[model samples]
Target: MKRRIVMSMFAGATLLASSLLGAAPARSADAPAEFGTDWHDPVTAAPPVAKPSGKSCQVTLAEAQFRDFTPYKGTYTPPEGCGERWSKVVLRMDGKVKGRQFDRLGHLHVGGVEIFRTSTPEPSPDGIEWSVEKDVTRYSDTFRRGQDVEMLIGNVVDDTYTGVIDVKVTLTFYAPSATAARPSATAASPVTNAARPATSTTRSTPTPDPTPDRVLTPDRVLTLQDGTVTTPRNSERIVAEVYATGSGGGCEEFWYLSAPDPAPYSCKAGDGPYREVQIEVDGRLAGIAAPFPHVWTGGWSNPFLWYVTPGPRAFDVKPIEYDLTPFAGLLNDGRPHRVEVSVVGVPEGQSGWSAPVNVLVWQDAKSAHVTGRLTGHKVGELANSSTYTPGSEHRVDTEGRHRLTVGGYVDTSHGRVTTTVSRSLTNTSAHRWTDGENLDALDAAWKDDQSVTVDGRGPARTTRTQRTYTMDGSITIGAGDRLRTVLTLGDRAAVGTTRAGRRIAWSWLDDTVEGDASWTLNVPRDQRHAVGTTSERFRLHGSKGCYDRSLTSVQGVLTEDRRAC
Candidate 1:
């Protein structure tokens, strides 16, 4: 049997009630905050103090200029009194483009060696303007007063109709303190030993390769294949891997360049394109996959030289891996089941989809017969839309003990904000599965949260954020198959005042096996009016693995004139 749980809590002071097992306990009015009070404070170190022994200097490495489909390079020379030994060195770039949007990659090189690289901010919704600041303290030795420094700016993409950009580069130098020890002249040189390994004709014996236990089969290469394609299935485990290059055209085109409309597009609207890969078994929907950029390739701006010397002359973008084990049972049938992979969201005439996908399956001569099905699928309608798909599977093996696995995926989205959450529960108990059974099980949960915010106008603003959180817990069976589990987790709470003087509080309770979790938001009342204040309460409960809930509320006193008291 399978079950689905749904819970919702509003923003203001209201009661949201739901039941999965039973009504959760009411939150206490005096409960402490979970997140933190001073979270809004900047978390950066104080500025470095200038040394009294040496003078500080600021130099303009390059002035503003406009370029099109070309690289920008300039030479810089430090001024005297900057000192050979420096404490702080910073590189700053102020840039703005009119009429179009673009993503620029900038590199700082000294004596032919690339030291640092960064990308300009994505075009703002209001306009194209940004300022980038990087700390080059480690490369201070390269800033010799008599030598020339090279700055390279590579335009990755420019969408401006006229293609005009105004950019300026500046370098700030802070000399070392009098009390600080200085390095010798030889140690101050930026160049390091660059020697290649000597060529030798010595033959080395090759080590034996490990025995192969897995098989990889190419299903479909979206970039090479014109339309939908199929591959023969023959493996014990199947994995769908997708490698996406550039932006999957169509609606994705706006991702690299600023959209002319700036309004949200939808897949059905013929303007909003989404990359969705669907998998089918015997012409039935089996699983769904989404394409994400590989960190080494498209995800990162400059992979050439960052941390190590000659890091990677070229980018070798890897593919994202998704487990299709939930549908493994349907494919494990003795007969060769038909499998189909399809790519949607790409418009005609525009091939924005450049995903090279492969479906790999492992084969085992003596595998068990398996059967599985998804049930209780539900989607919640709220400011934050959430979809839940849960499934249960059982494997019949020759051994007396059978394997059972329960898994699900929960995807939540609010406008440009989206979070993907997935969980799996597995156990190998006697074939007596029942409700409330204390079956020794293993549970794993993971969540990926992403949000994109656009400010009307800004020179330096955070426009995008991506974060991930994961937790794993397990229940062990004793010598006689007795259930024994020890779980320890922490809860987070936070209370702070917003810039608008509104008292805002947020709390989260992370429960592993489902218990009563609640939070309270207190609103200040006007003492002059002698009015009693009320606090908002939120509660969540379920039997699923780890249940994570966040409640945020703003509390303030309202006067008769409609102003904050």
Candidate 2:
């Protein structure tokens, strides 16, 4: 069985009660009350809720699509920032009460509806607390309301459990207004005095609520072109025989005029034989357009051709195209350029121009590799390993290419080292191990006795490190080194392991030791087996002060250039 834990915190004073749970909903004569409004004693009996059969609520949507300048279904509270307020908002989901609305509604019942004024607020598991993070109000309260509700399912019953009940809440109090003077809570309802039997309702308090509305626009339009002009005038429209494919798709036409702003306007997508408006200094409509068949997807605006002049209607003549396509005389100047476009008739204002996409087009450079030998050792080649600089700083710079920095240490005492390599690669194969003139076969194995205790923790014993060595001069390899490739082997080694899970040999590259009388490890290039591991045990060497020891282990892979695996 799984176990669960829960913790709770409650305020002592009854001042600002918003930070505490509120009294349960009022009980109707026919139903039981979920909870009382007073604070319960340490051992007060909890009230029970009436469980009804079926769902508890319902939801609905008013409209689908909304355009700019056009309002949606219902009045929506404007968002803090200004932009387009959703005129019509589609209801994403609706809720319905199956049959019982009060079965689990009792959770809504609480206590101390008002306790924030005099009490010092305390944090609670239920999320009730004072606003200590910001400077604003002192006597404040927090209360929750239902935001959404749904049912849950269990193993045997599909509808045995009710869904989570969400809540929204408002904490009311006075705070310094933007102007610095104390401001009243105009959005909050005035507190009332009890005149009779008390009762609280969702309508108990009024708030300046903002909800979204819904609205939809039409789709489809017709376009026309002049047959006589070899090169259509900036204001000319030609009749097209093509027909729109379907509904719900929106069509947009874009044209340019000589005005301070030559931005295009959009038209609602619909079958249009309607007169297209043109701009002229004299205010005379510039052209007549025939129908062009086009399909419109919801909310989509396509471009069309039009003309514009300078200063609302003066000397600048420019032609526009909904879709940028090459035509013999479409552009009177006959040069390629990007233009602003928008549709007309749609409640939404004209949109901005498309990003500057170059009709012109270019190629990109190549990469390569280089190789190097793994060379390094620990502490004069012996008992303790060599310590890496403060923080094991390792870096790689291959000519003009970016340099990669790695950080780590080599624990040669244990025949293993680790470092962050620039990139990860597979070592297909490797073989070669030479430590000293004695030339002991790499297969030979031995063990050593050791002990460790951090700050007098314990002198733990183990048999992990058995060999150590050093290298002073440079070693060269002429096999593979291309300026394109990067090959860096700080220190390498190769080790063998038995199916029994025992390590046979290794090498170390770097080491870091903190504290007096501590040891580190570091081995060299061709030792082949570089596998480092740590184990901790506690043993008391002194009568007192031995329980404070701690040990940690880090692991990594070695390169083949230094040893055979």
Candidate 3:
């Protein structure tokens, strides 16, 4: 597949940026019976990063090859021509690999802000390429000045494993329109560093308001240094995002399938198949959210199932966002405060999880110091259970849930602002496997709900969000020594915002993937006759925009695609 460039992000940029996606081509009359040296490149059905219509600037962030754990480190200078303020900022990463290799986890960080997290695809004998695009406008605060950069895609190379990951990352900045320009919005200026060389960050024109809230992303993004954070004294609002992943090819990589001690299972954990990400400030519970159950390309004990179409969000990992506004009152003391993150269900003394955090704050413009009190902080009892049933077909049924609510008031420049946040989470699964684990399957679902209300002298503004994730599949070794897999995965969400009990904006999203693959087991690469089919349907619509489409592939070829909606 040919790579797309983000040279000019104007009209038709979205379609042009649809790398390895869109409609399929004419099919051949005959199909190959055996696995070949090459196949179609990997692709996903997620919507492309929407670009605005305007002049744009592009900067190469990093380029490197990974053969070990050492990370690629460098420096990033702001785009020379792009204005300080922009309507949007888009991130694109293109990668290619060939020969033999295992799937590898990757990360990209700029000035300590983890902007992107992903996993690589196992390469074919010949070669394959893939691309990913994500909207990063909210990080405009971090891009307004020079910063340090780092990236890593840990891999290994030997006589047998030969594939070396090659990738290039870039950022595109789109200029704001005349009406969207914020000429007078410079009351809160961008961070200034005298040691760094000046670039386009110094602007004469007004910058756009990237978000409704006065976002104040610190120039030096925090990484929870010793589980501590020091926010501005005048900060009136706070939010934190966690890019958490379970990996290392150990039991944690397939964390959802792990079982508690003595379940006759190979992998054991203190808790089974249920996990939660929690946030705390000053040793008090502040916020919580559910982490997405992510599956890599080599997941489900079958690589053929994902050689063409991957599961949702597999290519572009998204961070779990937490509204910590209720803790602003306590964090606005100018002194360092203890901040912590913990995954709820992992066993003690075990290692295999990584959670990097980025804290975002909004400061009061008129006051040098803002102070108040945390009125309420409540945490519901955690509900978790795992039942093991042993028989011809051993089974484990598990259920876990938790809830938290926090309220506080911060005296800002405008007035006293009271904020309340409530969040809840639930996870349930049925894991079954035959004796010797010849046949294994899992059916699981998870839900994360959040609501935030901001009350001041005017009508209160509220935002509500409900997110769901599901996985149902099975891997079996049937007659004739044939190994097969049938699986389905889903990622969906519904969001709404209101004022004074009236809806102002809303949106819904649903992305589903299904596949069936089979091949001769315990055979040579050429001798194993492999066959597989995968399809994805993604639909999204609401106040911002609309995207509805479906794609299908057979024998590593995209067979059907249409924007039917």
Candidate 4:
């Protein structure tokens, strides 16, 4: 990781003038004949400042095009709660290699701050000591975060490609540095200070540590107690202790076993006035092993204890130097497995063993046959009961006939496990699980099969309700044959277009239909031309969950626009 440089920006006007003056070369007094004349000439000497140097650079992660590579990049749209935001970004640089002289370079720091400068005068024959414009830094400051819209690199040199260069950008979340001697983005003062001489100046401002409590120190071990050991296959024991630290209020300590080989473990010490400690194993509560009443000094000592369990699987615990009988419960069939490890009082949650530990245990391809009732199943749901004779034939008990009857409710949420079936599938009508289908067991099924793979870990579905509608009889208009209209859909029902080809005017029977909900329309009116009558028509288009055809069951004379469209 590259260290970041937090440049504390100073007042600009004075520094700009000073930089311009410093760029001029100095003339020797002996060589100049008119040295005593007007000093306000164009040949005035520039201020002597430290020479700036740099090398090639690269970025770690390719920034999102919306974040870095475009005009609107890095511009944050302030949310409702935000008013004024301040930040100090640290520019980190690393992986520098020597480059040829007089080459223009463009480099960006890890903090996304860019510095592009070029040599004004050509370099000497030795490829060094090239003079450059002091105006670079002054001009660079004008490039605000939101203003930069383009980037171009110029003047490449060969030797500069030696190694890699890394820059780190550390952005202060909401506020600028308070201890900085310059103008901060906080509440500005009425008076501003003048700029100092532009040179290599070190401004040491304190920064807040991101992980203050993460630092841990090992103190004296007051007492080490190996707690009551459990049987070698199951069960576990826990231990607890108390330690005194100068800083109080619930600190965590990581523990590791010292016997055989050192393995790391962790437990918590409580917030103190008086620090109390506790530990648990396999979810079983243990005894307090530290902060005993027998105290000899004013300070406290940390308690130490361990839980001994039988090892895993058929592997045997070798006879060691110490008491092997105490940890017999940990000696089981030797196959590494997941074990829960936790520490109390620390906000950091459980940190289990990084690596699984294998223990010897009895070996067998154990198989269990169990049967349960399939109640509360929906009609047409299937269930199977078959005896598994591994690697042999499967005997279907009662011919594996188990189907949900008319009134029984079936839940696809809790998966239907057909143990005898060769393929795993939610929709049995779909392909087999081995054929690109995601397979899930009982209690691990999704409420809806359409859930995305990532969210399929849980089961839940959307609730659906049915709507009902009924159409009223037709009404008469002018002349022609009377329109024989039948109610296609009831009130409040989403009506689909029953017919197509001819445009018809339709709307909801009432004025309240909206969205893709429901509608009523005009079919065909009568054929009266005494005053030149016009008929209304409704149009229909294909939409989600809707048919493409149109329907105008009854007709009405065009008076004006209907309330529903």
Candidate 5:
């Protein structure tokens, strides 16, 4: 039988959790052939946030339990004695839940800045505990000042769904090292945080970053009002982050498997399953990216597959970032502009997806007003096509791609800086299933390629980021009416920075998770005889450093924990 997993996702004060639980202890003896009350506290192979070994200060951000639809609201004050400057700030959330519940989405806003967005884990009958930490140093500007805070992990508690999400979030600020006042060379320096490769990427030989010369944050964060925002008049660089999620506990949660008009499937989209996250600025196309196909814990018609190990980023959802710098000139005009974010393939008004936008701007400090214009903006026609074939096994083949190029310039205090951005997105998928849908499966992949360049006084600099997301899985019911799920997910990227014609800094990352499980289709919890295996491997190498770690579990017991670099 499955063993009751009593593991803490956190490994002690090693991660700013001075009093948090330690690592998972040795697994208990395997029981009969059934799942247990709780599996391992949800954990991923992703690298933990890096913290400097210096004096640090902590501030309780929010302590609340989510129930119903009401959000926890309060005020946040900067940590005293930590000074206004810090080498790094990390946000950690410790949580516990019992009874039964489905996975839910959540977000945290500080001073109106969206510092964190994540999804909850479906709890076990025996209850469960988990923790997650993120490096939120980039938002130091917003954290240094006191402001209102709001957080929500919307949930419904009743006789059937009886789990309450109890969570506490805190921020730890690490004092700058003795050399923090010293200026050091930055291999990837253009956009201070651009080098970050989302989750699963680690610096092999991370160096303590010096105190930022200029606070590397938006002076003002504006949420779209009817898809519109008024940026700072002297904005030098602008970026928009989309907290996109396809949820609502429905087929839309599996949007990529959606079939077109005639292809019989659970989730159907008139235009097929080609979804793209697109942004328009000032009534013009600005950026386009493929949304990360997120599979929640309660996904794939099977929960047993994820009880021990969620997908690659199930617990830590990273927002999609778009370089809106090329549009800084037009936005700096001091007037409100229509900056809208939309998913291209959703049914006109169907509410399966939720994408809230947060626009961040880097202003030109020396100039009262920066003037410039969009010299060129061009977008290739979006290519989307799908084909359907019916048989014992129905099949739908979908392919789509889009490209965009935008260029502009702004006259700053230092000089005239020209910015150009080019991005391309492609998605392809195959969906197949039997007549009764006893057999359902989908194999899909998405690629987003981008390059941003800045040309001013020194050698022209450019940063290139290439990301790939893949999902391949199948859930089937056969003899004895047993349900089985076998799935694999991949999140990978290659980032490189170049100045003039020389490559200065670069990094490569790959994180993959796989699971397989089966159980009686219509049996009670104890009679299901559920069995499963899950594994994840994460690796990163580059100028930043090198790291490789892997995790594997059978039933609810962790069988392998290995790291190689």
Candidate 6:
């Protein structure tokens, strides 16, 4: 990624003065600042710090050795003074290649939490250096005094290769004063949901009620043998409920195995976090559930502990959820709409990770009343595709109101997903303003729900996930005299499950888990600068088995704690 350079506010004035006086431009009042220390040699032992230069630091490996598929670990600690300066921290990796062969992946961790991951350096031309930088300011709370930091690199090749690669890790910090001019969105206030009891049972198959405006349940179950379904009748508030589970033979298995030539990997089935599921409607893409992991299941195995347990073990089940509400309009036509589920990016025969899916659609008395189609659909590599039809646009002449609703699917590498967006504006001629035009008021809201089922290739090896979000805001323009705006995110939730076979081994529900945010912007008549402030708070609560963890952050401060089930 390329870095952007920002000139100070006085740059224009300084340049103009220098041009008129024919002398060098005078330096601005602000001075340059540096915060962390740097390292200059290989890190083979403790006290990873080399020459400590107050605010900048570095760690080097002169002759790092890595066997194929094996990972190497290194550790470092930031200076205590670097705390609370969240906006000024950056991690950089500079690799100098002595041999032409290098294929690996790099990861950085704080305490025990993984913060960054990247592919190994591409083989560079002789005499050229390869380097990458990452902003670590979001994790400022993890860099407290006396904390242990770990870095791991894995050689991803299938065969062993030996070479010299001079690697340097640098931590750069800037003074607080230097960051004052930058505008930032504030974090949202935290919201917490009560924990549910840990209980396991067979899948719930609820029947739809006959009431016109009540919540409707699925009357049928769709499995691998019954993947397609047609609506029994027309309905409103339609939703396709999906449940999926992942089995063995997944990427997490590939990354952690290390023995017996073709080593057998052992870990809980729900440990692998990157499984993705895609949902298709009537042959068109609908939604996706991407990498909803069971963070609290103790399913994850430590790579550094591979020597202790070297073979495959019996696995358990975990389940995830997905919401297909964006496609409700399309499914309400009382037509036999075909729905298909598949795992994204998992090659056939590589892992026995199969995803078994159960889809249920609910309806009401207003069935067969809604109509829509997938339109202007486009797909590209990874993050480059979009699926959706333009929605209805309405104008109310009496009230001078304009409204629009758009919904559709998006096919990306993560999975094929769906979303719905809406907006409205009201114009009033009640007040006089500075300009000739009448003052107008605007309010808009957008929402999206996405889900997917990932096929792990094995019988019953699958996972499903669902996430929904809503944002609404208001804006007022007073004939160019002053402008005011406020935006709020009302709801955000993600819940998922992983199954081993017929039962749920692990499941989790995270709603806005961290925080919600809102922003307000105001500009006075003839003012040179607009005033803006963002308020935000973050909190995430998750549970698996009898263990639970919650993380909360206010403004820029973060706190994390855990409890046993």
- Cα lDDT of all candidates, in order? 0.29, 0.15, 0.72, 0.17, 0.73, 0.30
Any residue pairs clashing in model 5, and if so which? 1-31, 1-32, 204-545, 204-546, 205-545
Residue 501 of model 3 has an lDDT of 94
Estimate, for each residue in 216-281, the C-alpha lDDT of model 3 and write its tens digit.
343233556677889888776677877777777667767888777757776678777788888778
What is the TM-score (0 to 1) of candidate 2?
Answer: 0.12
Q: Model 1 misses residue 264 by how many Å?
A: 27
Task: Supply every candidate's count of residue pairs whose N, Cα or C atoms clash at under 3 angstroms.
Answer: 15, 119, 0, 59, 5, 63
Task: Return the TM-score for candidate 1, rounded to 2 decimals.
Answer: 0.28
Q: Please identify model 6 stretches exceeding 4 Å from their true place.
A: 1-225, 249-275, 294-322, 326-335, 366-370, 375-565
Considering every candidate listed, which one attains the maximal lDDT? 5
lDDT of 1 by residue, 420-536 (tens): 212211111111112322221212122222111111122211111111111122232323323232221111111111112332221122211111111221222112111111111
Tell me how candidate 4 scores on lDDT.
0.17
Candidate 5 error regions (>4 Å): 1-32, 181-219
TM-scores of the candidates are: 0.28, 0.12, 0.88, 0.15, 0.90, 0.28
- How much is 415 displaced in model 3, in angstroms? 1.6
Q: What is the C-alpha RMSD of each candidate to the true structure, in Å?
A: 25.6, 36.1, 8.6, 35.7, 5.8, 25.2
* Cα lDDT of model 6 by residue, 1-565, tens digit: 0000100000000000000001111222221121011111111000011111245433331124443333345555555454445334555565554323333333444454344443332231232244444444434545543345555454433333333444556566543554354321110001111112112111122211111111222333233335655553433223443323332223332221111111111211221112345567777665444322211101121111111110111010112334444565566555566777765434444453334344443333332343434433343223311111121311111112223333544232223333442322222211111121112111222222322222222332222222333223333343333334343332233333333444332233322221222212233212312332222222222332222222222221222222223
**Is 3 or 4 the stronger prediction by TM-score?**
3
Ranking by lDDT: 5, 3, 6, 1, 4, 2
Model 4: per-residue Cα lDDT at residue 347 = 34
Candidate 1: lDDT of 113? 30
CA lDDT, candidate 6, residue 409: 42
Candidate 4 stretches with Cα past 4 Å from truth are 1-84, 87-95, 99-101, 105-153, 157-565
lDDT (tens digit, per residue) of candidate 2 on 1-565: 0000000011010111111111222222121121111111110001111112222221221222211112112212222222221111111111122210111101011121111111111111122211211111111111121222211110110242222222222211121223433221111111100000111122222111110000011011111111111212221111111111111112221111001111111222221111121111112111111111111100001000000000100000011111111111232222332222122222244332111110100000010111111221111111211111111211111110111112222222222222221211111111111221111001111111111101101121111111111111111111231001011111111112121233322222111111111111122212212122221211111111111111222121011111111
